[model samples]
Target: MDRQTEFVLRAVEDRNVKFIRLWFTDVLGFLKSVAIAPAELEGAFSEGIGFDGSAIEGYARVYEADMIAHPDPTTFQLLPWRTKAGTARMFCDITMPDGSPAMADPRHVLKRALKKAADKGFTFYTHPEIEFFLLRADAPWNAPEPLDSGGYFDHTTLDEGTDFRRDAITMLEQMGISVEFSHHEGAPGQHEIDLRYADALSMADNIMTFKVVLKEVAVGQGIRASFLPKPFTEHPGSGMHTHVSLFEGDQNAFYDATDEVRLSKIGKHFIAGLLAHSHEITAVTNQWVNSYKRLAWGGEAPSYVCWGRNNRSALVRVPLFKPDKASSARVEYRAIDSACNPYLAYALLLNAGLDGIDKEMPLPPEAEDDVWSLTDRERSSMGIDTLPRNLENAIAVMEESELVAETLGEHVFDYFLRNKRAEFDEYRRQVTPQELETLLPRL
Candidate 1:
């Protein structure tokens, strides 16, 4: 056995990790888990546990039913809250019965995209500022109770949820995850915790852990924590505004201190590619009907397809660089919501950015003035395009995009469209409370 596998085995025994949960996610980012006894873990590490892929959404069809979950030893960590039997967890990589990668697996999607970057002598790194809301357990979806009436960077008396957040950071630290900073967001009860930048794959794994840790902490405190894109209509929606950059060997490929935006040629190309394909990738970034509510909000949510330096309104921004921190010289994509699957989201992002580099796309003029204020005609004249306003619209754009299909692979492309179309159809049939209130009396 490898050293990492042996270490995990030893840790499980020493920590009394009785129920080891194997974790993975569907294409839509919903967490899935299965537990195995400690005795079976060694066999699982050597030979993966088998499951029916046809049963999983966006997985294989009935003809290709068999799949395997190979647990990644490096991800093994004890669930600090699961003291009943001292449970542990590890994320898995899904593969076919024959041991080939399952194309529909989101992790595999990212690995494929990363291979493209690797081929080009580059590696992608990401740091996400994940924002979420803490609401009272009984609070309605549209009317959530704020744990704190605090604004951006507000520091007030510690509430139950505040204690939960503190415990969450502590638990995350214990799991070998480094948190850069944590603070209250602009909206009441909303907060953001930024993770230190790491390779794209590792960052994706961290995101999964982060969500579970947040929920575990909240459950312990008796308040519900939500990562919903726009849980409340009046307040700012939660965003996973992620900063990304590329590296060539040990040097930051995105940094060129002399350029106008202090961006290297590769960085400019990457930005151009992302902006050019932003609309194409929007379906993956903001993947739900509720996600549109956040994207259309204009202030923090980026609606216009433009780039700027230190501008929050633009979809892409070159964050102000600090001297002596070359590693921090990167661009932030403000369009993505917390609802997205990080694995697939990162895959599409890397694919889009790499496409720009391969094509040597030129960066467009910066939109210093707010692009959201412009008329439709004005935006069109400036070559600024808006993202799809709804899931239906986004899916239609995705269905037509050759690049999206190529990046996501055929298995995922077909399955995702079918699932989303069904969701939109169900949404179409539902009569919301607003419809009942307005149409019942008037129509």
Candidate 2:
């Protein structure tokens, strides 16, 4: 047996594991799993577990429904909250009955993007500042109410959600997920957890697992966790501000000690490409109807396409360089929300940066002032472009994007557009409470 397989099997036996969960994500980025008893481990590791692809959103048509999920042994980990005597989980790669990688799989989309980066001698690393809210457990799914009045970095005495975060972080650590920091956010009942950087693929898997664990911990504590982009309008929305860096072997490709900004030409070009294509990818990066609400009503959620040093107002910002820590030099994309499909989001960011590198795009000037507050004349003079205002416009922008289409593959690209269109229609047809309150009496 290979080392990975041997390790997983031995761990299962030694730990007295009774059940193994084979985890995979559907195209919409929802976690889907099937549990297997101990007797089924060998066959699963060898031949994989089968499921009906037709039932999954954007997965397969009725005619060609057969699919398989090959468990990745390296991802084996015990669910710390569950009984050790037989519950473990591992991520899986979706494949066709014939063993080909499923094109519709979000994981495969990311793998293809990673391969493209590999061909150019680059490795992608990402660290995400994932933010979410702890809400009243009794609240309806459609409308979540806050659990506390805590604001940014409040003490446990003031931040009622503190113990919940501590518990969640402990459980995450036990599951082998390394968290860099956790604290209350700017909004009441909202929190942020920063995960240490890892390779793009491993980080995506961690993000998926992180969401599951966060919800599980919240429910156990008699609270509900939400990653929705804009659950509240009066308060700041939860965003997944992401830090991105490129590596060429052991060296940080983005760093240049001699440059005034300390960003290499490659780094500058990468940011330029990201800025150039930022509009096209928002439909994927900010994929929900409510996501545009966060973007349009900015609360540290960037909508302008510009980059700067130490400027959070810009869409991308070059973080302050740490002396002797070359790897810390990276660009932070601020527009992405915690609710996005991590695999697709990472893919677009990498590919967009690569495109800029290939084109040798020149970096634009920094926008140090608040872009949101800038007058139209001033913004136009600065050559800064705003992101799409709504999901309909975002979908339309994505429809015309060659980069997004190629990155997602035809299966996902087409399905995503169709699905989003339906969502827009459903949303537009609704008579919102706000409309009823404001318009009925006046009209």
Candidate 3:
């Protein structure tokens, strides 16, 4: 057995872990879990635990229901919230009965994209500033109530949200997930947590774990947490403003010492690729119906496709470079929300950036003014394009994208498109509260 596997076995025994949960995600990024006793750990490491994939969303047909979940020992961590019988969890990679990687598996999709980057001598890294809302646990879904009314970075004494964040960060650190910062966001009840940067695959796994941990912590505190893109109309939406960079064997590939902006040619191309393909990939990054509401609602989220050095209004922002810290130089893509499927979203982002590098795509003129302030005519004249106004439009654009299709394999691509279409259709048939309040009495 490998050293990591042996180490996991030893840790389980020494820690007295009675239940080991095997965790994986479906196509829609929902966490799935299956628990096994301690005695099955060795067998699970060798041969995987079997499950029926037919029941899973976008997994397989009933005829081909047999699937395996192989635990990744590197991801094994004891659950801080579960202390009764000593529960531990590890992220799993799904495979078919024949031992081939499942095409529909979101983790496998990311690994494939990472392998492509590896072949080109590049390693992708991501740092996400994830935002969410803390709401009253007993509040109704449609008329939800915020737990607090604190503003951006307000250090209110005796704040419940603050205590929740402290506990959440402590638990995350206990699991070896590094957190850089936590603060109150602009909107009431909304908060932000910035996780330290890591490799793409590990970061994706961390994001999934981060979401679960936050929800679990909220439940323990007798409150609720939400990652919905646009929970309230008047408040700014929750977003995952992710900073991404490429590295070449310990060197920052995005840094250029002699450049005016200190951004290398490779860095410019990466931004160009993201701008060029942002529209097509919007369905995956901002996948829900409400996600478009956040993008187009004139909030902090960007609606136009453009990049700038310090302009938060633009879709991509290149943070200022510190003199001695070349490693910190990176580009932040702001359109992604905290609710996205990070695995597929990261894969598309990496592939699009790599495509730019491959094609030697030119960077466009940076938007010095606020993109939201510019008139439509002015934006059009300046070659600034807006993202899809709604999920239907986003899906239509994605349907014709070869980059998205190739990055997400055929199985996932087809399933996601169909699922989104169904969701949009269901949404369209509903009579919204706005419609009733606006036209019901008048009609």
Candidate 4:
């Protein structure tokens, strides 16, 4: 057995872990788990646990439902919230009975993308500033009541949000997830947590764990935590503004101290690639129908396809350079919502950026003024294009992109498109309250 696998087994025994939850994600990024007794750890590591893939959201058909989930020992961590005999968890990689990686596995898709980056002598890293809202537990799904009225960075002596964040952070840290910052966002009851940067794979795992920890803590407090893109019509929406960087042998590939913007040729090309393919990838980054609502009503969430230095209005923002911390040089893609499947989202992002580097795409002119403020004519004249205005438009654009198709593989690409189209169809037929309110009295 590998050292990591042996170490995991030893840890489970030493900790007296009663159940070990093997975790994986569906194509749409929902967490799925299956618990096994500690005695099965060794067998799981070697042969994997069998499950019915057809039961999952975007897995195999019923006839070919057999699948295996091989636990990644490197991701082993005990659940801080669980007590008594204790419970631990490990992220699993889905595979077929023959041990071949599942093409539809979102985690495998990311690994494939990362392998491409590795082949190019680069490593991808991401740091996400995830935002969400805390609502009253008893609040109705349609009418969510905010747990607190505190606005951005407002910290009262005895704030419920603050206590919740504290507890959440504690649980995360216990699981070895390092948090960089936590603060109240601009919207009432909304909170933001910035996780320390890590490799794309590990960071994706952390994000998944982060969401579960938040929800667990919230439920324990008689509250509900939501990662919905636009939970409330009048309030600012939650977003996962992720900072991404590429590295080579301990050096930041994006750093060019001598350049005017301190961005190297590689960095510029990456940004250019993201801008070029922003529309095609929007369906994955902002997948939900409501995600468009958040993007269109822009304050922090950007709707246009452009990049700028310290410009939050643009889709991609290059944070100001700190000469002392060249490693910190990176670009933030702001359109990604907290609810996105991190694995697929990061895969598409890495592939897009890598495509730019491969092609040496030219960086477009920076949006000096706020993109949201610019008139349609002015934006068009400046060559600044807006992202797909809605999920339908976004899916249409994605459906035609070879880059998205190739990166996501045939299994995922076809399933995601079909699934999203069905979702949009269902959503369209629904009679929303706003539509009734406006049209009922008129027509």
Give candidate 1 misplaced runs (Cα > 4 Å): 140-143, 321-324
Question: Which candidate would rank higher by lDDT, 2 or 3?
Answer: 3
Kindly list the per-residue Cα lDDT of model 4 for residues 1-443, writing each as its tens digit: 98999899899888889999999999999999999998888999889999999999999999989999999999999999998769999999999999999998999999999999999999999999999999998879888999988889987776789899999999999999999999999888999999999999999999999999999999899999999999888888999999999999899999998888889999999999999999999999999999998997887889998998878999999998574478988999999997899999999999999999999999999988988888999999999988999999999999999999999999999999999999999999999999899999999
lDDT of 3 at 102: 95
Please, what are the lDDT tens digits per residue for candidate 3 over residues 37-112?
Answer: 9999999999999999999999998999999999999999999999888999999999998999999999999999
Candidates sorted by lDDT, descending order?
3, 4, 2, 1
> What TM-score does candidate 3 get on C-alpha atoms?
0.99
lDDT of candidate 4 at residue 427, scale 0 to 100: 97
**lDDT score, residue 226, model 1?**
89
lDDT of 3 at 262: 82
Candidate 2 accuracy as lDDT: 0.92
lDDT winner between candidates 2 and 4: 4
TM-score between candidate 2 and the true structure: 0.98
Instruction: Quote the RMSD, in angstroms, for model 3.
Output: 0.8
In terms of lDDT, which candidate is stronger, 1 or 4?
4
Model 1 Cα shift for residue 187 (angstroms): 1.5
Q: In candidate 4, what residue range of length 10 has the lowest lDDT sum?
A: 320-329
